[model samples]
Target: MIDQDHKLGVKEANLVSRKLQLSGIQGQEAEALVAEIEQQFGVDRVAYDPDAGTLAFSYDATHCNLDLVESILSKRGAGFATNWWNRTKRSYYRYVDQNIKDNAGYEPHCCNKVPRK
Candidate 1:
């Protein structure tokens, strides 16, 4: 299968999907937040489920991270679930996002590609 290019700043190889239980906001407010997030660079897509109270999104980790989204949530009076599982996932997401961002500029060279001296 071939991987096609996604939105701006979003590469298929770097795409990540995340779903988080949300709190403190819903209905039109949640939709508004989703719209705001969707407008950000590197964000492939965003959706908020009112019934499940969860926000699911796809983004390119190398160009965008969870921190940027979280700031918007905080400012808009939304928050993640306080359960242990969600907390753990949040921490892991942060770690992976930072890792991707840190390595985004790195170019790997194969040993076989080196020219003979």
Candidate 2:
């Protein structure tokens, strides 16, 4: 009778608890391990959607000031040429250095003057 709603089944939970008990871990220490495992696997920014059967993810592109994220969002926006969410097929798109420089259509807002690091 292993309950599966808690991510881990009852048998697995019992095994893990037994192992922790054998290791002399009690109270907060044992609880901390369980919490850590849950957090590690649980989706924060990246995950797979079971209903959609698609991979969902997010990225912060500040490192290179890349425009891939912006482009994707723009394409997904209303009145755009493409609707990424409605597509049934998986598609891959990437930003290249050349595309950033040559594409006049992809003008990003610039501050003109950069502050000292």
Candidate 3:
């Protein structure tokens, strides 16, 4: 299990660890690095499914409605794929604005789709 004190939640911790791995940090040290982030950010919920290679996080359970998570998983493949990183490079504010505009009245559901490996 991941360290709960880390503020990054589950998904962000996983993403940070992955990025560290890509940058040459591996094994326990990588885990520690992510934990540090969690301590700083204060994650409320985190889920890492090795089978799907996905990491998910939310500030609180209520904020992470099932349908929204399912939408993110469906739209983006498991793990931090190349496309996922690429999308992050676009204007951060733009995505936030778009998400706000698009997600109005959107009700999320739990994902029942087959997990990716």
Candidate 4:
């Protein structure tokens, strides 16, 4: 018999692990993206597997949302899953992104001015 309880409390949570369809993305590129998310986006963490072409990221909803994250990746010419839900998400993010840009005193997550160790 198949078990349905195994799927409990997954997407209902704040942290969602949506994988992007980054075709032929390399390890170095993935690492660089990770660094970008951490340094510029203020993402708490990111897990990218070049072989699988998947990236799992976690951010504080209070500070920033996934739409902003997508905006950054979109700027890098990265592609995302073509699923209906993801597609809808991308669209919504686009709207939020514009508002973020238009709003005054609204800094985009973090900055790159920090000195490297």
Candidate 2: C-alpha RMSD to true structure equals 20.7
Q: What is the Cα-based TM-score of model 4?
A: 0.52
Please report, in order, the local distance difference test score of every candidate based on alpha carbons.
0.88, 0.29, 0.38, 0.57
Residue 53 shift from truth in candidate 1, angstroms: 0.6
Ranking by lDDT: 1, 4, 3, 2
TM-score for each candidate, following the candidate numbering: 0.87, 0.21, 0.29, 0.52
RMSD of each: 2.4, 20.7, 14.7, 14.4
Tens digits of per-residue lDDT for model 3 on 37-64? 3343323544454444444444322123
lDDT per residue for candidate 4 within 1-117, as digits (tens), equals 122321322122233334455543566777777778766433556788776677777543435567666666776777576778667866775565445435634556557677557
Question: TM-score ranking from best to worst?
Answer: 1, 4, 3, 2
Residue 86, candidate 3: alpha-carbon lDDT: 33
- Model 1, position 34, has a per-residue lDDT of 92
Candidate 1 lDDT over 6-106, as tens digits, reads 77778877788899999899688987899899999999989888889889999999878898999999999988889998999999998988888788789
| Better structure of 1 and 4 per TM-score | 1
Worst 10 residues of 1 by lDDT: 1-10
Candidate 2: regions farther than 4 A off:
1-44, 62-92, 96-117
Clashing pairs in 2: none
- Global local distance difference test of model 3: 0.38
